[model samples]
Target: MKRFVLLVVVAGLAGGGYYAYRNQRAGTQQAQASAVSGPRAVPVEVASVETMTVNEEVEALGTLAADESVIIASEIAGRVVALGFKEGERVKAGQDLVKLDTAILDAELKQALADLGLARDTNERLRALVQRGSGTQVALDESTARLASSEARVQLAKAKLAQSTIVAPFSGVVGLRSVGIGDYVSVGKPLIVLTSIDPIKVDFRVPEIYLSRVKVGQPVQVRVDAVPDRTFTGQIFAIDPVVDVNGRAIRLRANVPNGDLALKPGLFARLSITVDQRENAMVIPEMAVVPDGVGKMIYVAENGKARRVAVELGKRLPGKVEVVGGLKPGMQIITAGQMRLRDGSTISVKEKPVQTSQL
Candidate 1:
């Protein structure tokens, strides 16, 4: 009887200990489940959408080129006897740039002149003899032919002599010199480069879809990498009628007045052309937009929860973007910490939301 009582007491103690352990484990698991179900709110910066006038613009890359450019070259081969103009100097049209050796040409011209004089004297004597009945008519005609032939030779010599001097074809700045005085050069050899930089041109291409949007006299804004702070404006002076077959793009050209000569040839340019405009368009900061696959999306705050909204985008401006659809005016959108957010996720505004009017 005493042993049975001892076994019962031990069994009662073991059952009580097992029940307590199970209860403790169940309580711990319940606490962990509660913690997981309640998520911490993500902090973010937000901006409100507002109605404003936004420009519909198209952008393209371009290159700046001189209004007129040419490579100065020699027309006739000879020794460079004299350099009339200094390199990198502004020259006027018809100004002498280089003078080739003209000794041989000058002698030839003088000899031709002497021959012409002798022919004229002979022709005069023959006419006098015919008048005096001392020369035949055929002889007089022959002398006249000889006089004409000599005159032709003189003209040819003068033309060859003029070729010895190379003159500037237009008014512009000259480039580096390839030869000095007394340097022998061949015909067609480059002597210098001339470029007219004022009223420079920018060449760019736009998609064929925008062919109708681009036309002559349309305003364009240009910015070059070399001159980042300055914005140059010009009008579309030319547009190619044919679309490029390989790229399906239309070539465009604009002329910008470079009166200060700050822009140069071969500089890369950023071009923007206003194609259309809309009044009272919804706009927000560009950071508020999150690109979705083949589309765009944004996170709007509603009742302390994020609402993923799909938006159709339009003309993009500096620091702001036009919202064409899916977002309304006066809507608050989360701009920062969007990576940690999902639909219906809790959010806390970190800073005062930026007003779209201030954008």
Candidate 2:
């Protein structure tokens, strides 16, 4: 009985030792898991806040127009005897474009001159007789009236003769002719279209909210799908004083040089106007900005930790933004891997430091 009792006590002690060993091992494993699951540094890409020239620009759509455009028309009715300019040819101001049959007009002018000469001779004879007191004042007055009437006829006849020739009012390129030689044209007949296109005009509109910021002489950059690879530069020349009631926008016009005539009238254009510019402005990549409530925030790396800072943004460029406030030059701002970051969270940069120029 004593031997059996000692064995039972020894088994109890062994069971207690086993339970203690299992508890110790569990506690060690839990501690090791806690150590392994501790918070780790987040990997991110960072870029330095830089200072450079930045432009505050406004974008708008526009249509190109010729500097001057008009439709050539005849003022008198006659048969076209000659065409001075070929289709699509450039002509100078005062260059003749068409000549009408002037035979009838020339004959009328000759008759008017003959009558004028006869009236003048009679008026001289009447004046000499009146001075000698041999002619009545009434007779002299009648001759004087005839002479004035004849002179007026001659002036009218000369004007009609001159109108038989159609001339270019301004230097421009002519479109297809509406009437060919030997085609009879009437008064106010449409002949052709003339366009002056060397320095083209661009018509665009912007929201009225930008009216205060825009001004004459502001630089504008123009692009068109037709000329995809080239950009045209121009200056603002006109602005409408009244805002458009239907669209709540203001109209503006710019003049751009097209020396090579590559830009055509009526082409759709995209324009960017640089209303303002800042030199040595603080700039950073747009990816660094984070929306926080109604304001904006950015994660800045300082001393191996991230600091969420509220920033005031200025102008925005392609993949870049102007930091008007809340940042200084040479400060590193998080560009990527910001989703897992919190204020005061540790960070490990995954890439080399980025610069604004590199973006």
Candidate 3:
């Protein structure tokens, strides 16, 4: 009877152990399901729009050029004898640059002078004879003709002598000399590069859209990277009438006062153009704006929901852009979390106490 009681007690203990193990497994599964189900809150950033004064402008790539630049070449062919100016020196217009070997030309001039003296003496004597009727009219005329011919020969010789010297065509600074002393220079050979740096020019192009804003004497602002912490001013002196078909931009020329020569020709520059004034413009961060097909749009926060609003773009800025339409001031925009939401998508906008000016 004791043995039978022992078997019943052992069976009862085994049954309890099995029941406890099944209950534990069921509780663990129920807890895991509860953790997996819910609307998770996504982290996001937000910003509000504000009215500000925006100056409208167009940007373009431009090259820096002098108002007047040219490569002055030799006009005569001869051995270079004397170099009048050094490389990179400032020279005035009409300054003699190169003097060629003129020994032959000098000899020719002297011979012409001697011939003129003889012709004048013969003409003087012949005129006296004609007055006394001792000479025929033909003889006197022949003497006069000889004097005229001698004078013509003198002029020709002088022209040849002038051809042996080359002078600058304009006042400017000279670049490196391409020819040295004793170098044989042919006609049209480049002698040196001459450029007018003072009152130097900065040639920049403007977009066709702002063609009307640019005119003769329109002021242009220029900044050169070579010289920092300085800004120069120039006036529009010329504007091309035709727009470039490939670039769709207009060519513009501005003459800057480079009195100090702080700005050099061929130096790169950053340009800012101001055409018109605008008031009460709504501006937003560039990151907040998104591109759509054939146009552009941005996301705004309304009623705790993401609303995609179409916006007209104008005067794209470095960090911000001007909203021409489809948005109003004092509206919040989803600057961050674009990947997490879509149009009419619910979002929890956590205003992080950011500055309005930061947008």
Candidate 4:
């Protein structure tokens, strides 16, 4: 009876040990399988790469200026007798703006004319006498000299009279007048300011590195704070040949039509110049670009795995970036949830991949 009880206890102990060993082995096998399979799939949102028309552009700040500007001044000293133009009115070229008192100049001209007449009569009489042999040759020569001096005096008097009237040099808007009627003005005194606004100009500067790209007749888009709702278009008309050593930039000027006189001189301007255009350019959302050290990197979805790639970037547009190299059209790029991804990481797209047109 004692031996039977001992045998039964040994059998139970062996069975329990065998069962424990099987459970331990199974757990180890499961762990090994998990290790070989790697981490779970990462959820991400992706957008497909596509081609589009892209413009290579350069941005800069500038200032609006009048096409033509000048301060009108007097060329001779006189009392202002008549004012021909109203303040702030447009004046035509050669239209008189100011007329000085010409009374003294008129009297001077008449006196010179009278002297000229007297000298001519004397010269004629002397020539007649010399031809008749009644006067000396020396006397006739003196009379001729006197006639020439009188003619010069008359021309000088006429010029002084013409100078009394100041006319517009070009068609432009006139500013305030400094001298009023009956006011005496000296030579070079400020009379008014004139500015031509139609076909206004903008002055801007760009980096010298773009010298080869910039050219005359390139289109430019301009905007100003004063005219927030309007965008002005123009073409580059002039470029400074010398580059500024201090700023390493080249100056440029463009002409914008202002027929309505909306643009004025000295207004601040913002300018964009289109340097080049590409018909088919590969682009992706800017959010997909990941900064990798000094270069740029992005993750592409391939066969349910994230493949990291290095890319060379070109021009950057609003919310998009141009991929110059290392990318092709129709490839899906991770736009969001890429933080947890590594090279060859398994990915689970949360939604249908967005098309390039949708972006």
Alpha-carbon RMSD, candidate 2: 4.5
Question: For candidate 1, lDDT tens digit of each residue in 1-359?
Answer: 99999999999999999999999999999899989889889998888897888877898999999999999888778899888787777788899988999888899999999999999999999999999999999999999999999999999999988989988888778888878988998989998898887789999999999987787998999999889899999889999888999999999999999988889899999999988878999988999888788699999999999999999988777899888999888999898999888999999989775568753
TM-score of 2: 0.84
Deviation in Å, model 3, residue 157 alpha carbon: 2.7
Summed backbone clashes in each candidate are 0, 0, 0, 0
Worst 10 residues of 4 by lDDT: 350-359
Candidate 4: tens digits of C-alpha lDDT, residues 261-296: 888899999999999999889999999999898799
TM-score of model number 4: 0.79
Ranking by lDDT: 4, 2, 1, 3
Best by lDDT: 4
Q: 1-359, model 3: which lDDT tens digit per residue?
A: 99999999999999999999999999998888867874555556788886788886555556678767898787667899998898878899999988999998899999999999999999999899989989888988998999999999999989979988888888888899888998988889988888898888777877688888877876677887788899887777888888999989888887888877778878988777667668988889989887778688888887877888888977766798888889888999788886677787778877677466754
Alpha-carbon TM-score of each model against the true structure: 0.64, 0.84, 0.60, 0.79
Better of 1 and 3 by lDDT: 1
- Tally clashes: model 4: 0
lDDT, residue 146, candidate 2: 98
Best-to-worst order by TM-score is 2, 4, 1, 3
Please give the TM-score that candidate 3 achieves against the real structure: 0.60
The regions of model 1 sitting more than 4 angstroms off are 1-53, 127-134, 277-359
> In terms of TM-score, which candidate is stronger, 1 or 3?
1
Off by over 4 Å in 2: 1-45, 336-338, 346-359
Error of 2 at 323 (Å): 1.4
